[model samples]
Target: MNSITVLGSGWLGFPLAQLLSKEFSIKLSTTSSSKFENLKDENIIPFIVDINNLNGDIDKFLSSDILIINIPSKNIDGFKELIKHILNSNIKKIVFISSISVLKDETTPLLEIENLFKKTNLEITILRFAGLIGYGRNPAKFFPNGKVVKDADTPVNMIHRDDCINIIQKVVKQDIFNETFNCVAPSHPTKKEFYTYCAKVSGLPVPTFDSSKNESNKKTVKSDLLVSKLNYTFIHEDLMKIVF
Candidate 1:
């Protein structure tokens, strides 16, 4: 078992900390000073530290065998300094919790970071996730109008809370070096199609399709490799009906 450190102990980080601590030594870090007690109660070693405010304590944090970067893209700039600092530490492996948004319509900085990790001693694993829909964390919040994007035919990719943690557990055990996997549900449903389903299920009004430019383009995510290799099955593949 490795000494694991999760950098951002938020929603997904808490679960990952719990998952990893069962088999490894865990040190979960977060910006929240108040949450560390809960983490300690959960049997996780909690460190209330912010990467942005670090003054060399990063070296202390990277003292683990594996460093899991759970901070979001808004803090991606910190990653540049983080990778540099990790090289100076005892850590040998890294797992970055990135998002499937990188695969969207724009060029992303992840590819560059992926290349940076590849050149180092740090054996890195990148988990690119899709729409994360858990209890209070709902994607429906983004589409509050009970309407999805214009491309009604565009498929929606999602993975449940339990499945994400489970897959991360499995992937770490493999000791695979420098692997990037898209973490998403196996099912893909059209945008409008799924939205209407959710609206009906949630007892909300079925939004009128405006036939606007957005209503016509298809956006999909690919994760065939994750499913075939890990045998990952999603608990909530289609939330449009169940979540509402």
Candidate 2:
């Protein structure tokens, strides 16, 4: 069986590692030692890795055939050191869990670090996921009862955590690499429509939007490349259907 190492066992990484453990020999990394036994109970080999500090047995963690980096840290120097270690290790393929936020701003650290990974010789796939939703992470909760939310007309670029995991699984399983793809739902709904529905479903107070703000050039993300290249279908394509 092929071995895979998942760096940063947080929200998305933890569940991803759990699912991948059934098919591949999985090694999961966590910054906290408290989660070590939890990972073990799920049949995932655990490692205490802190990329920001460059601490832990990274060499051993990189022993797998494939590496999945899901950390939220944006430290350029830390990733620089991690990349150096990767070049020296047995990790031939990498699936980087980037964010669509990189497109929103050029100054974003993820874009700079992404460039660093692009120059490497190893096969790498960069998945830029939009605002993560699902698994009790409802967007409605972002606004309190009477909080005024802006961008009422602006379209929301978001993805479900389940779809995020499935897309990564497809990329790794199909050997898709050296490509950058946006992971977002095809349905682009207005923030007001989406959040109002979410709030009603979750029994939360509906957020009020500021209609005074005119959003002519609203930023919306598309997953055309992902759909075309991976031939993948999003499980949560309709944002309105998402229930908490």
Candidate 3:
């Protein structure tokens, strides 16, 4: 079985490792020692890694056929050091989890980090996900009660956690490398419509929207390339119908 190492064991990474462990030898890293026992209980090899300090035996952590980088850190210097270690390791493929926020803002460190990986000799696939929802991350709870939410008419760009995992799995299994794909759901519902429905379903107070603002230059991210290239169907294609 091919070995795969996950750099971060958070909301998306931990569950992804669990699913991938069935077919591949999975090694996962966490900054907290509290999660070590839990990871080992699930038959995942656990490593304590802190990229900010470049701590832990990263060389051993990278001793795998594939590496999935799911951390949220944007420390360029830390990645520079990590890239040096990656260049020296046996990792053949990499899947870097990026955010769609990079597309709207050029000042984000994520864009520069993406460029850094692209410059490398190793095979890399970058997945730029939209606003992550599903499970405990409900969009309805984003704002407090009676808060005026802007962009009521603007369409929302979101992807479920399940779809994100599935997309990563497909990319790795299909050997799609040296490419970047925007991972988002097929539907683009207005923020007002979607969030109101979410609040009702969750039994939360519905948020108020600013009626004065115009819907000009609305941003809606699509996963057209990801869908066509992977030929994959999303588990939660319709965000309005998503529950938990």
Estimate the TM-score for candidate 1: 0.85
Expressed as tens digits, the lDDT of each residue in 1-244 for candidate 1 is 5688888877888878887887888888878778865444455777776766666566777778888888764544666777788888888888877788767634577656666677786788888888776657644445665444565556777767777787778778877547789988777776667667766756666765544456334566767888777776766665554563
**Regions of model 1 farther than 4 Å from truth:** 40-42, 75-77, 145-148, 213-217, 238-244
On TM-score, the stronger of 1 and 3 is 3
Please say which candidate is ahead in lDDT: 1 or 3: 3
Lowest summed lDDT window (length 10), candidate 1: 209-218
What is each predicted model's overall lDDT from 0 to 1? Answer: 0.72, 0.90, 0.90
Tell me how far the alpha carbon of residue 6 in candidate 3 is from the true structure, in angstroms, after superposition.
0.2
Tens digit of per-residue lDDT, candidate 2, span 180-224: 998999999888898899999999889888866666548888999
lDDT of 3: 0.90
Clashing pairs in 3: 135-244
Model 3 regions lying over 4 Å from their true place:
40-42, 214-217
TM-score of each: 0.85, 0.96, 0.96
Ten contiguous residues with the weakest lDDT in model 3? 35-44
